[model samples]
Target: MRFIPSLFTLAVCSSFSIQADNAETAIERITVQGDLRQQSLQQLAGSIAVVSEQDAKRTSAQHLDDLLNQFANVNFSAGASRGRYIQMRGIGERSEFVDTINPSVGILIDGIDYSGLGITGISDMAQLEVFRGPEASRFGANALAGMLNLTTKGPTATPEGKLSATLANYDSRQLAAQFSNSVNSQLGYSLALEQQSSDGFIDNTYLNRDDTNNIDEFSGRFKVNYHPTERLALQFIAHLSDQDNGYDAFSLDRNRNTLSDEPGQDKIRSKALALNADYSGLGFADFNGQISWLTADSDYGFDEDWSYVGIHPDEYATTDRYLRAREQITLDYRLVSTPAGQLGGSDWVLGLYVAGKDYDLNRQFWNWDLWQADSFSSSLERSNAAVYGELTTPLNASWSLVSGMRLERYADIYSDSSGNAIKNHDMMWGANVSLNYQVNNQALIYLLAARGYKAGGVNGDALAKAADGNLTELNSKASFKPETLYNAEFGVKGSALDQSITARVAAFYMWRDDMQVKGWLNPDSGPQFAGFIDNAGSGRNYGIEMENRLQLHPQLALFLSASWLKTRLGNYITLDGDNLSGREQAQAPRFQYSVASDWYITDALTFNLSLQGKDAFFYSDGHNARSKRYELLNARISYQLANWELAAWTRNALDKDIGVRGFYFGNDPRDGYEPHVYEQLSEPRRVGVTASYQF
Candidate 1:
């Protein structure tokens, strides 16, 4: 599997010369909406990936997980129904059970912030933008490693509608609809709704149920645009998602058949509203502002024993569940200099941001033991305020200097039922400077330097439990120091061969101070383990990424992306009294790549084929377990005539055996409870068909 991508990439590149005459097809120009102002993808000085609506439809992706592998050096951790965390450049959380997280990666949907909440369904998404490096100056603390931004489809002026249906293996099914229309010249609106469900791949033999691990999700989005005047525009959006999924994935035999009797659930209910405004009525500058609010509730739990009562005579019947509720409010206002408002031949942007977020959690672990029915409740609140500014000045016709900075203040209050209370406050800042040299209309070269940071916090749960025993643990390690990273990068982006080929290349080196890493804590007496954050003195990560697109013919296009990464962890001591220094960081795969082709066979028929693969890496810190490297193949063919379309798709066509997550523990009693590696497998081969109608 590791040799596949090299051969595939070479074969595709060699054909670029054969179809020289047919290489006139031009690549589409893309706009980056995640930034303060809309800018061309090539003009932005960053490592980014943008997946358009058309590309998503071709892949038949209903969820964010489906498109994550298309980006270089991007990965997700699957500890629940879906991947609960997103990792970039070897940084991000793998799981969050008892601790409140200050995430290294940021997640945004539309005009609202969903940072640290993983991701949501993208049934009506317009595009997905993934920033691969730190965006400290633009995004601040939440984007220490990078960020994911999702934009939903907006309102339209003319009446249009679409209905789509899909069916697949494992009793998977989906139904969706989208419509847009205008009430008048000044008002327009759009709506999208979707429902998806499937009897998951797991088979719970003990419970005699195939749906013990299942998926049922409903999502909707609504948007309205009011353009009453030329200088003022207002857009309002509403978003909702309801999910009820089961979590019975892991097995003692490392197969799909599970023995858990008390299958747990992974459920989330969310509702949000956002109002965005753009006004040019002001004389000096144009204004862009947004106010948004979101409320979400989640229920996640699992059977701790992984077996029924009778299966293991000595095992206790226990289940762990977490019920949480969260609310977030944000206000962002910015002013961009108008053409007449430029100062000293420089353009500037000034903005202010305020956000408030709080969550309450209840953990109930029920067991047959009379005194071990542990019930713990906790709450955390976060308040943030920031002021940021950016300035770009031309140094000549072919060069420019860009600089930006952000100053922010954060306060957090946390408390729990164990008589433990903690308060943390930090005033931090981030900044970036870039020098851009535009060699010509077809190419731009840039050098950038940036600094990013992540706030420190207390490990409440771990600290409370440690106080109950005489374990040798240091108080200084209980609260880690704030993390900071200094990064330097060189990049180039442009098109070539008469605009038939577009490519972007970037190489970066980063140094981390007080790197935050998860440390597994084992109880002195019990098998229960807790995870907490600790400062791993220092670390370094360097990587190179390439994104290329070639217009082989008028009816065909090829996409290629690759990343090579190297990460090293500095000296760090674990809770169990072990030293790990100069070890490769977890989840930081050495190499990752993807190659795809989209071809229009005829006027009404199209075909797409993609192959993606990654190198194996360590699964966690303080362990030697690793996943096996693997490759996956996907293909789709669609035929359209008039307003009707039919498509058939298959993913992982070869049915390769691969593991997405792994754990090393002593869970199986059959072998005297000896520790062995257990893995959660990736999806096998799946085939499906889709039908769509538009009017």
Candidate 2:
């Protein structure tokens, strides 16, 4: 897949930027820790994107999932909506049981890791940053494929608040309020609350299930900063949130428009605290340290008799519980602008990281006074120390070369509820090099290559016990191996026609060794399948990405992005000697394209429109019964009066019937059932109004 944007397109975009605003004026820019001279998104040698607060307001995004779904390179898994489980560039959440993510993509909120679905949603975020390629060489080990970084709003100097109320067509009503205050010269605080209720879109096929869903959320954040002196400061942050909401409907048959009797429900809670301190201009080095902790708990339930026709009325309830907690601490020392040495002007960084987590899960069926519980528990601890440095040397007036490397060690252990134990230890190395040539101030081209890795572990749920003994170990079903990726890319980023427009294009090839696949098999207790982690033989992913942003006069702007991917797997052999060749990776569409446009109209009135399209994807490894291609269109209209703004928006305006359904490990065609037993449908035409104020 090769993408080449014509010069005519560039010229047209440049003409539209004649009355544009400064790109960095509305953003809070921060330096990339290791490379202080490189631009945040434009000059970096990796794929990166940033979402501004202004953009969020234009879209009226009330939550993190709304923002993620609008991005081109991102794909959301159709699940129960406890929270969004995402797949980026073909990797993430490969399993349906126990809410297990693929472990290749890393998610962080305010620099704190959110390991599971319990803590994935951030209710009051200010901005979200996504790095598309292998950022692990700079961010961490877990970001083998990419990274998602979330930033929350901090306390401001304002001392006012606003209240809003809304009503919609879907039997929906909403109310929200926000307040901000400055406690003193050094302390600031902000608080927010929201409540929403709706009568769902589908009918509950079973009895005794809730047809109306309601959600109430509360969030508060506090910050205290001491700028007692310049160049040295300390900041403290604390955040808390609670959410309770009813699950959306999942269709059992798309052709028949049948819904489940047991509509899922969820209860979720989360909290986080962190402290950061920094000192610059030290005689020898600069020092920075941060420590943070987060915890989440969730409860989910579904009806067991929703599908069976003749089951007793008493056997109508079933449920699952997933709980997770995580903590992390980090410290770093960097030597900048060293004096009188061979490495003068070069940067060096040494860091130490320590983290730990615990996971608990249980599932059961509810029949009058009879309860069966299948439980699993595991613990994880990790300690890593690394030293990394980058050096750039000038070859000529038009060329320069940069090189860097990092070395680290990792160790982990997994213990199940039955006392069975598995441990792993390994030392890994990662490195990168790039050659950059300056074509002019408006253009630059670079070629780079790098390697990334993800730690391996045993299936936390693949344990069996014997009745005669306290615990027994079953032979490991799959010899899971560490996943490693090697990537080579060539790209260009630049601003043209006097910085009125910006554009980027890149082409790359990435290969995965020992990939992990969640092979599904029908279980005895229910109709759904459980995820069994196995080592996929081998696979290759190659793609091209293109993005453009143009300012069509002062109050108008436009953005466009597209991705083309070609992925294949081979050597996948099951215990039965069956081979999986010519199979497409799950949830990875071959072609995706997106475009968005905005018209300010006036300072008081704004209009926005966006569109996204994706090609068909194979839900099963056999490349049979693939999902149909789909497209979604969204529009927004806003009007401002003094300090308040009112907006109306519609999502999925076309009401396209989108479905993500397929057979897992084997095909199931019941006599009276359809080809796909159960399928999750994307939300249909949704319309809402919102009001916001700033003081």
Best TM-score among the predictions, by candidate number: 1
Per-residue lDDT of 200-231 in model 1, one digit per residue for the tens? 88899998999988989888999999997999
lDDT of each: 0.82, 0.60
Q: Estimate the TM-score of every prediction.
A: 0.94, 0.85
lDDT of 1: 0.82
For model 2, how does the per-residue alpha-carbon lDDT over 1-695 read when each residue is reduced to its tens digit?
32345633453344333332553453224333323233555546666667766766555555565566556556656455533555667765533454234367777766666644423333355667777766555655666777777776666676867677666656666666666667776566666566665564554544433352334455555566665556676777776766666653444444323334445566667777787777765755556666777666666655433343443342333444444444445543344333433254543444455555544455443322124545555565655666655566657765767676666666766565647567767776666777876554345567888777776666554453221122222244423666777778877766653544777676778887887766544333233333456778777877777667778788878888777777877577653345776577777788787778889899899999988788887665543556779887889998999988888998778988665444422222233322443455655677888776756
Candidate 2 overall Cα lDDT vs. reference?
0.60
Give candidate 2's root-mean-square deviation (CA, Å): 4.8
RMSD of each: 3.5, 4.8
**Number of the top lDDT candidate:** 1
Worst 10 residues of 1 by lDDT: 15-24
Model 2: residue 125 alpha-carbon error in angstroms = 3.6
Q: What clash pairs does model 1 have?
A: none
